[model samples]
Target: MSKSLLLLFVAVFCINCSSDNKESDTPPTEEPLYFPPLTGTTWKTKSVESLDWNKAAVQPLLDYLKLKNTKGFIILVNGQIVMENYFNGHDAATNWYWASAGKTLTSAMTGIAQQENLININNKVSQYIGTGWTSTPIDKENLITCKNLLTMTSGLNDATDDVTPSALTYTADAGTRWAYHNVYVKLQDVVAAASRQTWSAYFNTKLRDKIGMDGSWFASGNNSVYYSTTRSMARFGLLMYNKGKWNDDVILNESYFNEATNTSQNINLGYGYLWWLNGKASYHLPQSQASFQGSIIPTGPNDMFMALGKNDQKIYIVPSKKMVVIRMGEAADNVNLALSDFDKTLWTKISALYQ
Candidate 1:
């Protein structure tokens, strides 16, 4: 109870409190932010000719969607936002569901694994997730591979949960035929198991870090991960346009990027790794039998490709044209709305600029 002792005690307490405050002030370490140099009036409305569209026409297409309730849409040309529009109270920053489009991210991770020498796409899924990766019948498990999952040719239909066998079983065998299903979902665990890191961690460190993607992982709790804002989706498309290179960094291995973007398997009309190819030869039809024909509207060349999602989350990459276009929003059950027409129309308006 002496004065000197009490004073010393008080001073020690104050120092401890100050130290705690300083520690609290320090920022948490996170993956650094990647701000791509993409902004300004180009994204805003401007003269069609001023922007370099082969034949830029969106008004008619916009008119077509006028009566429909949709989320948002963005259009970028040669890595620049040539046109952007929003609906349903959504904005550029809104995070819409990429659905199947997010699958491209998964496929991209596979490419990253190849770059790091984790595993090869030609490797069987069993090699990564172990034997019986799919909970399907015994016959189906033996035939699955990373390539099969990415190309949608795993031959195991998702009618019943492929993860949970209590659901249903549709087919067996690998290259017998093709049907779009959730069989590829199992690859998430396979990739994570092989890399020995959580899918989120692996993605953030491997892919997101390279391209400077700002989107968060959508499926956080259940081992499912997909995400992106319209702009982020555009950046992914641009990465593909740049052949998996961000600036000077080779984000994706050139060989893997080439095969992943090209038609890995011909199951669907146009399918590369998780990405989709759009060409006259593309035999796959949107849920609705939409046809994309014409020039001027932004589209992939005979070699053009795309990353398409369930709700119309699209990253269209055309190598020959040197163009990347991103469209994100609800397109009615992931159906293509005048996609063929839009591709043709936009190209017409954009083509004038090029000439």
Candidate 2:
């Protein structure tokens, strides 16, 4: 062949090779975010479909608790869903407020801070915020420690302003007694101040995002409340179920997770770092006689933990059974509503299904 013709053919081959190389070096498109596998997908009910909870006895319990208006419920047993139901006008996408139930989340964040060496719950809270945390009588405030805040024994005069207290007076010596108040809410601010990040940012980057939880700040310090869909709440419960590991990722320090869920505080019979325990010792009613505090469903296993909100938002995690039961509803304290009894009944019915 002629030299010119050979050279032309060689140039074309080189060009083609380079083009192919470029194409190969270009990264392949990534797959979209992973959706968790659905095992009992058939049980997922639409708002229009009647739930399969067929026990005749369950209907009375539902009527008693007004489950018709329930937003959503997801029950998991041994990592498989035993039941998942969404009622009228509600679905997995709807974000629900955790209210005081969110306090459990705060406790989790505190453990995260300790893991990162940003703050220690055992340290004196006053040490991080200075002596201003001291009570009006001064000496009493010094006794207040970060542990008091975690355990809700800070002794701060939380009666007047629970959410945002401009002056946090250690009314009594810390660790002297127990009180369920918003004074502990201020610890979120203290945590943010110490960590130098907003509550939302810290939680999302550290906890939610890592755990694949689609959660947002529904509320905070009586002001910035966080909101999350029921599925997201379930994810948190599942994460805790595995001892701070979610989807094979360790989002919280295992040590902290154990400490948070374990019965640490003595004020509430079933209280822990911020989560509630399933001990019947804290029962306040006949409904709770079959149920327990600190979880959405009372019939859940005894080793369960929960994140409870004021409006009946709850995330219940039972490590022993590998179960998570989540419920979100409107208990606005409006219309003279009391949801605890209803919740107890709902749990009792759900427990029957597992049996």
Ten contiguous residues with the weakest lDDT in model 2: 40-49
Question: Which whole-number lDDT from 0 to 100 does residue 53 have in model 2?
Answer: 40
lDDT of 1 at 111: 82
Off by over 4 Å in 1: 1-47, 52-58, 65-70, 135-140, 166-170, 220-225, 280-282, 285-301, 332-355
lDDT of 1 by residue, 1-355 (tens): 9999999999999999999999999998743223265443233233345554444345654554443445665555555555667777888777777777777888888888877888877888887876655557666766777888787777665454345444425465876666566667667777798889987888888877666566777653333646666767777777877777776788887888888876676445566777766663545543322333432123335666776655455666766655666666555433454234444444444444455
Residue 10 of candidate 1: its Cα lDDT? Answer: 100
Please give the distance, in angstroms, between residue 142's alpha carbon in candidate 2 and its true position after superposition.
Answer: 2.4
lDDT scores for all predictions? 0.64, 0.66
| Candidate 2 Cα errors over 4 Å, as ranges | 1-68, 133-135, 218-223, 280-300, 332-339
At residue 207, candidate 2 shows an lDDT of: 83
- For candidate 1, the TM-score is 0.73
lDDT of 2 by residue, 51-151 (tens): 33445654554453354466777766544455566776878677777667777788888888888898878777667777654445656766776778777
Best by TM-score: 2
